[model samples]
Target: MIRHLVLFKLNEGVSRDEERVRAGVRAFQALEGEIPELSFWECAWNITDRPIAYDFAVNSAVADTDALKRYLEHPAHQAAAAQWREFATWVIADYEF
Candidate 1:
């Protein structure tokens, strides 16, 4: 099994408040059913006061590395990724179980 975790920090000047954060969260959560290799998915809005913390986040579990790769290259994922540029900075990850 492979657990693919990703944390996202929004671009500077972007709001990290409840409403904006929730919209980003929903955008990722909606991809769950659309991507077949996505075994499970979760999203969260960071509420910490730390100076350098991520705002949007995702944690997904896949059957294996191949499934994870498929998920990354899937068309549904590509479409979802297109909606991220406005608010997201970059993704941080861990691919090992």
Candidate 2:
């Protein structure tokens, strides 16, 4: 399987309480059942206030690289990402387990 990880930092002026941010969080949290390639999925807000901490995170797993590609290209995933692009920036990592 492949582990797909993403950490997101909200833009300087953005707040989690905003309607758009809340919707973005919900959109991502719903991906597990929405995407067939996702064998596992979990996402949440950060609980700590650390300088280096990201504001949100997604931890998910897929069967393999091809599955990972499909997840990335999926319509729901794309729409969520596009929305986030307006208010956040993120980094991703993928590896085999």
Candidate 3:
């Protein structure tokens, strides 16, 4: 299996409470059962107040690299990513397990 992790940092002056941000969060939260390649999915806001912590996180798993690629290229995933692009920057890591 492959693990796909993402951490998002809100842009300066952006607030999590904004309607756009909330919608983006909802989009991501909706991805679990929408994508067939996703075997697991978990997303949420950060609870800690530490400076180095990201504002949001997504932890997901797929069967293999091909499945991971399909997940990345899926239209729903693309739309959600585009939504985040307007208000935040993110980092991702993927590894086989």
Candidate 4:
């Protein structure tokens, strides 16, 4: 199995905090149902006091590295990511088990 985690920080005035967080949560949650290789999905809004923290985030579980790769390259994901880039600072990590 593989875990793919991503965090995003929206640029100043680029997005409404609440709405952007909600959309990120919904988009990740929907991936499990929409993407065949997505076994699990979770998203959250960061509220910690840490200065370097991201604003919106997603954690996803996949069956394997291949699945993870596919998810990253998926058209839907690409489109969403493009939109995210317009308003975000991004970070990503992948783990295997």
Among the numbered candidates, top lDDT falls to 3
lDDT of 4 by residue, 1-97 (tens): 9988898888877754557545655665666678787888877777785888778788889999888888889877776677676667788899986
Off by over 4 Å in 1: 17-23
lDDT of 2 by residue, 7-82 (tens): 9999999999999999999899878799999999999999999999999999999999999999999999999898
Predicted candidate 1 versus true structure: per-residue lDDT over 4-95, tens digit per residue = 87778777777766475556666677888888888888777777868877776788888988898899898777766666666677665746
The list of candidate 3 runs beyond 4 A from truth reads none
Candidate 2 local distance difference test against the native: 0.95
| Candidate 3 residue lDDT tens string, 9-97 | 99999999999999999999999799999999999999999999999999999999999999999999999999999999999999999
Model 2 spans with C-alpha error above 4 angstroms: none
Model 4, runs deviating above 4 Å:
18-26
Q: lDDT (CA) for every model shown?
A: 0.75, 0.95, 0.97, 0.76
Backbone N/Cα/C clashes per model: 0, 0, 0, 0
The positional error of residue 33 in candidate 1, measured at the CA in angstroms, is: 2.2
Clashing pairs in 1: none
